[model samples]
Target: MISAGIDIGSITSKVVILDDGRIYGSKIGFTGYNAERAGSSIYNSLIEELGIKHENVNSIVATGYGRNSVQFADKTYTEILCHAAGAFYNNSDIRTIIDIGGQDSKVISLSADGNVKDFCMNDKCAAGTGRFLEVIARALEIDLENFARLSLQSGKPASISTTCTVFAESEVISLIAKGESRENIIAGIHDSVASRLSSMVYRVGLNPPVMMTGGVAKNSGLVKAIENRLGTGVLVPESAQINGALGAALLAAKQNYRQ
Candidate 1:
């Protein structure tokens, strides 16, 4: 059966098609202002790119912050469940999932059978999130792509004490005025993010074979910082950005088979 998953995140929308539990194709695009539109656009684009007819898709599941916006989806699932499933599908041994998305961060503990045991989320503030990093990157006048790389160059990361994003930005500006190196400031930002997330990780109980998903997983510096704080290695899947979509697609396939 052909199944599709749509993830409408705050910053981006992703669509993945699966054929018999295998990835057929996937696409990603900015979410823009209209989440519903973004979801349809991405899905449409993917099918067109893959030369698949819309009717050929047997089941569809939507996920992410704007998941409910996909009116055409057969059903919607929480990102927590989706991420857990995605991680397990990638590697059954993964017992933990750290998802740092554009606007939120979450740590999920999973059972060996791929069920979600417990999960904690940081959604109240931009701190420890990609948005926080974006603010810091802007203050340092560096592109987001270079933000992580520059942090790795720092001999010593500066200390950012605040968990508030606005306060942290102010602190970053102060550091810049004090002649602090950009690399140090960047590294400090990563450290601050890691520190904030580390608490959540422990709150859910750190489990081995941790998998890091979401947009921030692509940030090597943040991954290293988190690894340092946790004293363990974190795994990043090849399709980390669309892990939720993949999971949703898998769910779609399962639901389709049950019917």
Candidate 2:
């Protein structure tokens, strides 16, 4: 059976198509101002790219911040559950998941069977999130794509003691005025984010075989910082950004089977 999953995140929308349990392909695009339209657009684009008719999809699931906006989905699931399922599908050995998206960051602990045992989410603020990094990158006049690489070149990361994004931006400006190296300032920004996320990781209790899933997982500097703070390696899947959609697709397949 062919099933699909749509994940409508704050900054982007992703659609993944599965033929039975195997992936057909996935598509991603900016969410834009119309969330519902974004969901349908991505799904339609994916199906078209796969050369599959809409009728061929047996089931559909929606997930992420805009899950409910997907009226076409057969059902919707929370990102926490979807992320756990996706992480397990990628690596069954993974017992912990750290997902940092556009606006929020979460740490999830999974049971032996890949079920979510507990989760801690920071949704109230933009600090320690992708948005925070975006702001910092803009303030530093650096492209977001080059931010991580530049950070890695630093010999001494400047100290950024604040967790608040606004204050952090101001701090970065002050650092620039003080003639700090761009590399050092960028590294310090990553370090601050890691410090905040590591606290959540510890709060949820460290489980071995951790996997990070989300758009921010692509940031090598942040990954390194987190690994250093946790003193453990973190696995990042190739489709890290769409893990939630992938999980939703897997769950949709199961749901179809149950019926």
Please give, for residues 1-259, the per-residue lDDT of candidate 2 as tens digits.
9999899999999899999799999998999989999999889988998999987789999999899989889999999989999999999999999999999999999999999999999868899999999999999999888988999999999999888999999999999999999999999999999889999999999998989999999999989989988999999999999999999999998877323
TM-score of candidate 2 on Cα atoms, chains taken together: 0.98
- What is the lDDT for 219 in model 2? 94
TM-score of each: 0.98, 0.98
In order, the Cα lDDT scores of the candidates are: 0.92, 0.93
Cα error of candidate 1 at position 33, Å: 1.2
Model 1, runs deviating above 4 Å: 257-259
Error of 1 at 1 (Å): 1.2
